[model samples]
Target chain A: MQQDAARLKVTHEGDIVQVEFTSRKILDEANIAEIGDQLSALVEAEHRPRLVISFAGVDHLSSAALGTLITINNKVKNRDGQLRLCNINPQIFEVFLITKLNTLFHIYPTIKEALESLRSGAQTGRLQ
Target chain B: MRPVFARVVTGTLMKHLKLQAGSRGRRESREKSVGLWCSEEFPSQMAEGRRVEEKILSQCRKYAYGQRDLFALKLALEEAICNAIRHGNKSTPNKHVRVKYRITRERIDVMVEDEGSGFDPAVLPDPTADQNLERACGRGVLLMRAYMNNVVFNSVGNSVMLTKFNESYSSSDTPINSTTVAFG
Candidate 1:
């Protein structure tokens, strides 16, 4: 029904929902909305209550995409869920740091680290 | 197929290239300014801004713009386009968004115009403010102003022009100032 996980890859790892962007760069306006909707649906699918957006494949993303992240973060917040972002490239990381979004998100350096945090309920801000 | 010849000239010399077609000759004069133009009707298609940005970035590289400036311009231009599309046009497919970027050795000037009614930049709440930090889309204008050397808006507020001067390296390839960007 959902493009067979075309835009992003969704997987479950021990009660953690990991959403991986399929594109190397999610800079398009139309794609941003699609991503937001997909993440929202994931939030609604079952009661994982823990989400992690992996940027391992992404290099660049526009501010609109950042806005989408904010929307998704807010949605997760409202649902009493936790969202973690990991494997963000340096350039994209600069955007988060510039906008001070680094403070709002629990960012990890790797997907494994993020998963471990989710399992252990550890909160981290920015990857140093 | 006939071969096309391109020449590179320095200084203020007027360079002309002659293209031969049959018995006629066409003389093309090279201009010093490099520019990119794009127009989209709202609700605009996805990645239109990114496409325009790619073109502008290519032009910047062709003009030997420094990487720092190129990155700053990319961010500033993208933000301006987003503002025009999302705020000025309100994502209405009927309205049109226009973007133009003119880059010279001295500076890069970008203009973004939208069909929607103008807005008051003065009235915009600071996106970095504590109360407004979580807002979805209020930081575009601020980023543009922060990254570009000069940002000016028309009286109607539907159009904005951003300018960024070349840092250190001018048309003569000499360092003027090391400052890459300025905040206002």
Candidate 2:
């Protein structure tokens, strides 16, 4: 099967992979699935892959997108990697609060903060 | 590839009309105050679903729904339509999902129904539970309920109704609170 077009813009800042969504809305199931696959591949390609996903330009996200994030977080954890999410707007952040996912993932207000936390090995604990 | 037509009143509105007349006999009822109503059915495909969603959002823009309201409706509508397509219809190409909505100055009410044997929403596992937090699914209904003012599931569960009051509309008589209710 042909691969779907990449929905993420990924950059490498040292060992940490910085990812941003190319679309304003990450609610489409196919797109979310493709993004999950792409992120999973990135995690599988390296040892202890450190990832930072930024929701800077994103305006809306569905529960499916959140599910994909959880899956990616689990994959990173299984590989002994770290993942940090940042740049989430208030509306999207409300989703995390409502779902109680705010406690599960490491969230930061900006990419610089996320990078700093990753480098300092802070907020690495996962909810059991 | 069903043709979508906006600006038409729906049967649901007529039912509301009767209820309002019998209850309060008032001219300011929601059914009589609607600015636009859209009812359409689309094939069980994500692309088709998205097209309908955009059309509805465009109609909402005409009413000047704020960015926050638009964001919440978009998120909730996506979840409802996705559930109708994937879980309710099992993504069968021949099946269809019916979407009906009414937009008023105060709120937007939407209904999405699919052609499949429905499951009980009560049986859904809580995605927020510690053991289930890492699971990759079952959060759609939760998000819909959280963002919308009210979410209702029909007895069979093949259909869902979502409503969100405009931020500026501060009427204390909200028909339903921000929670999931089961209706026949």
Candidate 3:
């Protein structure tokens, strides 16, 4: 197969990196691996990375994708960074709830809230 | 009426076996009872796995399955096929994963088998556990059971069967309490 195109759209706002997925479904193994690598690179570039991942248009994702997110979360934590997820659709959010990942990651309903939470150093709008 | 089976082999090592039952006189009854049945075998490649998954999902779309049902099946199918390819087959060059499924208006049943030594699902650590929450893997089976109506493993653990009832979307809304696992 040919090489995968960039899967993430990354933009930097001050010290925070805002990322979005170009593909609506992140279920493919190769694509997930590529996304993981890209996210890792971003995390490594910052002394204390502050990232917000928006799942605005993503319709589907697999356990492998979730695993990648968790790995990214760990990398950020190790560097004393922060990661926030926002705009997750109801179905996907239920996936988090089922795995109890809703409690592990800081999730917000909008990118504004996530950015604010990161800037304020205070978590908010976490789903119960 | 007896069931008729037709098999077709493609260049990509994908084999499709379609089944239909009934005589000309019993067509209506057969349509009601048999629905659609398909079995396929493909190489242990993610692209091949996805091709087969889309075929199955297209059938669901043809039947006008609800959005929630589509989401549930899509998630469950991805996990099942991924597990079979990556873990069961270990991504061996020549290893193949076989998918057999039956779809009716009321429910869908899928079985995925791989050519490798299987592991016991009972021993998998709970990904939701605090100690394991940060772990980067092992949530596939949990998500499968959560989305599908039933998930069963074979006695040797190499094959798993997943079932979901079409009109039973309410069950998926229930909070995760316990998973139903059976060995056959």
Candidate 4:
């Protein structure tokens, strides 16, 4: 489940589209757009709309990557779907905690926790 | 010989102190530093650092492990290597980069040399200035000066010589830096 160049693997189950971010350097202003645009196109093409990003492989996320995910989350909400993050590595999760983006996004422990919430009709703390 | 001619010759000779900067970074075991040579044009710059830096770190750590100088040594070396790739060679594959590490009892010296004709290192604008604040570049020079005890550009700036004073013997007074320059 490796995609050739962008260093991410995407998998889908029902309406939930999973995106995993991977790169050697900490995500910052430099290469964030290269990953963001790819995710954007995948979102626009898929009508089902739910997104669960498995952030296990990411080492660090700068402000730019955090903002990109936030923008995508807004777009998903406007479409009446959900955007969540799962399997966040502890290092990157600490970065999110430091930035307080953890307060904004619905973060779950696993992909199943994120997807099952969508299917069961209960909510996970109302997106923050 | 005139006193001024003798004086001129004496001072010019004295500045480049022969503090014995020879011997490889290896302690007695003599394993060469890794990920350091012929890797300027790799597909990813950070990837190159991760591959080489770990090996270089391990080589030094075997001898100088837990010596407080490890992190700064690793960071400054990577930044210098990265700067050689980005600023020196401009990421061009044709150019070659050579990195050599020499560890003396009192200091560790890391030299990064590039094939390109070097620039005047002094002319580089301060990166912390307003216009350059957001730039991803120029931060390496700052880190090198901060981490290394003395940094010198040699062989016409084609190479950077960075030396970190060993922790145990390094003094706050810095006896080598106390000389005053007097010009009327």
B102-137 per-residue lDDT for model 3 (tens digits): 676656777889988998999999999999999999
Which regions of candidate 3 deviate over 4 angstroms?
A1-5, B1-31, B168-184
- Candidate 1 global lDDT: 0.70
Q: How much does each candidate deviate from the true structure in C-alpha RMSD? A: 9.1, 4.1, 7.6, 11.7
Q: How high is the lDDT of residue A7 in model 4?
A: 54
Q: Which pairs of residues collide in model 2?
A: none
Clash count, candidate 4: 0
Clashing pairs in 3: none
Best by lDDT: 2
Native-contact fraction for each model? 0.31, 0.92, 0.95, 0.00
Native A-B contacts reproduced, model 1: 0.31
lDDT of 4 by residue, B1-184 (tens): 1111101123332233222111222232122211112122232244554455565567666556444566567657766776676677777765656665544434555667766677777988775565544343455566577657777777477678776765755433322231111110
lDDT for each residue of candidate 3 in A34-109, tens digit (9 for 90 to 100) = 9999999989999999999999999999999999999999999999999999999998999999999999999999
Q: Give the per-residue lDDT of model 2 (tens digit) for B66-175.
A: 88888888888899999999999999988999987877767788889999999898999998899988898899898888888888888888988888888855554544
DockQ of 4: 0.11
Backbone clash numbers for all candidates listed: 4, 0, 0, 0
On TM-score, the leading prediction is: 2
Evaluated on the second chain alone, the candidates' TM-scores are: 0.68, 0.83, 0.75, 0.62
In model 3 chain B, which range of ten residues has the least summed lDDT? B174-183
